[model samples]
Target chain A: MIETDWLWGLLGGLMIGGAAALYLLVNGRVMGASGIIGGLVDGSARDQWAERLAFLAGLVGVPALAVLLIGGAETHLSGNPAVLILGGLLVGLGTRMANGCTSGHGVCGISRLSLRGIVATVFYILVGGIVMVLARHVLGWI
Target chain B: MARSLFSALAGAIFGLGLLVSGMTDTTRVQGWLDVFGDWDPTLAFVMGGALIPMAIAWRVAARRRVAVLGNPLPLTHERVVDAKLVIGSSLFGAGWGLAGLCPGPALASLGWGGWGGLLFLLAMLVGMVAAPAAKARIDRITQAA
Candidate 1:
């Protein structure tokens, strides 16, 4: 059966991609999602703060807007809020250690054929795979 | 001039493809490969869906002269494969599995009242800030070598 998830994935992809591209085009920066948020350290990091907030706000607001404008999808965060919290901490650390988030490194960096980026991306992907395995296979945590 | 713009255009499209493939969803992503044997098979389709659009976008972008922005897209790069790669990868994996989040989606998920996304974002900055010092040490050793 055709899945609504697919459509969500498609349109959502386009919105994110479009924003990243536009952000880069206008600002001439890597569309690293983390960097944008980091800029939120102050009221707004000049253009950095403004755009970052907007981008992040857009990330949340847009999706909500989309669901409101169009419809809602089945996406929901499961597991414990504690899990999500712990998970976020690890990811924050990992992205820093890796020097780029998925959007910055995984999408922007890899596309540029950056060797360091590629290597780092591989690390991210492999680790993601391993974690998924351990979470279910070993830890028995969904 | 045109080339760089076009390249950016292509990259943006590729990213969108990744998003569409459901790669941005932390739970769905972990769900597909959950090794405890609850293996969610949907991730493969996400991968496939991404590849499809990616291939097509590249082919079209490749044929263009000056990108839509009137300049060549800078495709310059640096490829470093070293000890850092191994260590960095290991850390990234550990963090990801533990958090069930990655850089992209974690940031994206912030919209959904993602407390996890916020926490991850915080740590990610700490990590990036530290990367320079780590790189400096690596540089020192190499110089001594």
Candidate 2:
């Protein structure tokens, strides 16, 4: 199961990359989730709202359908409401402020060798690692 | 019409990839982050696999002025690393470490994550909506200094 997990992760990641490539090639848009969803409400990309909505529809609907077909997906999110809310807010604000996330900066940015994407990815990953150390090991707050 | 269809198709594939990659599992994400503890390196393969094709795609894109659909390509040229990028990424990283959720997996896992996922999504949307104001505030402070 462990080995298969790695194999599947690679395969799945390939699919994700393919999807992003297709979006860029066919639609000429960077396929960043936060950018897509956030732009809609923020009016930054208001003109392309249709394309964004359509993409989000597929993003949300397909996963739900897949779960129905393959049974429920697994998760390990905290049950604490406070934790969930705070985490959600941070993710939302931070992605918007940085103008990207793992998909934008981590995948697309690094792939294109864009300096901002690379720097953002490095900072986020490093900070994430540090937070994990503090929260999970040292302080045990999480 | 074609653009919307392609966008939707891409989103579907992306969602499926998230599921197949086991990224929908928070434990797996947390495991990857827990380098001091039982670190799961499966995510490395995921990033590696995704990068190969994406790098190729980017290379192809670098040569093209427009998309195959005749739309203008958005090539981000900004290279300035400033406070917003650093601060925002730091906050995002902290949040991700706290909850093991990012926008992609958070939305993808909605079906199974139940109420927690919904609440998180809502709160995230609120934060996203408020992001503009937050940016304005930051600008104000930066300018005032």
DockQ of each: 0.29, 0.80
Return the lDDT, model 1, position A14: 53
RMSD for all candidates, in order, please: 5.6, 1.4
What is each predicted model's overall lDDT from 0 to 1? 0.54, 0.86
lDDT of 1 by residue, B7-44 (tens): 34433443344445565565666665465555555554
Candidate 2 local lDDT, B1-145, one digit each (tens): 9889999999899888988998888788888888898899878888888888888887788789699899878775678887788888888888888888888888877877889888888888887888888888887888888
Which runs in model 2 stand beyond 4 Å of their true positions? none
Which pairs in model 2 have colliding backbones?
none
Residue B43: error of model 2 in Å?
1.5
Q: Give the least accurate 10-residue stretch of model 2 chain A, judged by summed lDDT.
A: A70-79
lDDT of 2 by residue, A116-136 (tens): 898888887788888877887
